[model samples]
Target: MSIHLVTGAGSGIGAAVARRLLERGDELWLLARDAGRAKALAAGFPGARTLVGDLAEPSRLSWALGHQAPPDRLDSLLHIAGVVELGDIGDLTPKVWNETLAVNLVGPAELTRLFLPQLRLSRGHVVFVNSGAGLDAHAQWGPYAASKHGLKALADALRREEHPGGLRVTSVFPGRTATPMQAKVHQQEGKRYDAERWIAPESVATTVLTAIDLPQDAEITDLTVRPGR
Candidate 1:
């Protein structure tokens, strides 16, 4: 069975992806921000392993992961954890921009760098669960969009640089999914929240799995998932 280290496995697309991986007998590692969250994820995913690393503080990630015992054979590293606080560019503060970039972009970059040896050893995939904002920025999405846009660049550069080594990199841009994050976005937008109106987290999970499961002879560099209905 392939092994994977997943971030944001507590809920939404990350949870869906973790569940699917566990159901299929893959060795799964869930990255939790704290001991309490790690315990919770361990309880939620019975056979899966848990690692403590706070993505919000990217600078401390190396030290944190160093203390934890991560998987030795990693087939993929799934970057799905993210936070958002919607505000117009003019109204947003430096703290907002810093925190958003720290969690969404810098954290993922550091985590990937730390795991590069293992990933290179296995020719593994690195999947970034980015948002449509990565492609197009809109009002009140400055910080989040900027971070995702940087993520796209990260994935692109990594793919090109690692191509000779057979490492795969994919950026999955999912449109408003029915996630707690999406609900919060709606709240920030002062709009009605309807789970049915957005893409299901499971659908995005499927897209992620498909990208990772693709044959070694081919690669899906980028994928976009939008709501069907």
Candidate 2:
């Protein structure tokens, strides 16, 4: 069975993706900001490992994972942890902008770097759960959009750097998924949260699994899944 590591395993899309991986009989190592939540989720699976820490500080995450006696063979790294704080460019605070970049971009980038040796041993795939904001900016979504755009650039650079080493990298751009984050966005917009109006997290997970299951000779570099209005 392949070994997978997933960040942001507490809830929403991250949780959904972890469940799907478990169902496929692959071993999972989950990381979340709350260790207790990750432990609770791990209890449901037979042999799952959970790490508790904030992604904003990748060094802490590295220390925690190192203590886990990480498996030598890692088949995939799924970077699903993210934060979205919206504000127009003019109104975005320095603190918010810094936190956004740290959590959404730097954290993932650093995690991948720390795990690169293990991943290279197995020729593993790296998947980044990006958003539509990475593609086009919205009026008041400046901070979030900037972080995602940087994520897109990071993914592209990694793909170019690692393809020669047999590593596959994918960036998934999902549009307005019906997640807790989406609920928060709705609150900001003064609109009722309608689950049907957005894409389902499970659907996105399915796409990720499909990409991972592709023939070793083939790679799906980028995928965009959007809601059908």
> lDDT per residue, candidate 1, 114-217, as tens digits?
99999999999999999999999998899999999999999999999998999999999999999999999899899999999989999999999999999999
Cα lDDT of all candidates, in order? 0.95, 0.87
Off by over 4 Å in 2: 44-46
- Give lDDT: candidate 1, residue 16: 99
Residue range 176-209, candidate 2, lDDT tens digits: 9999999999998888999999988899988888
Tell me how many residue pairs clash in candidate 1: 0
Q: Mark the 10 consecutive residues where model 1 has the least summed lDDT.
A: 65-74
Model 1 alpha-carbon drift over 4 Å, by segment: none
Displacement of the residue 30 alpha carbon in candidate 2, Å: 0.2
Can you give the TM-score per candidate against the true fold? Answer: 0.99, 0.95
What clash pairs does model 1 have?
none
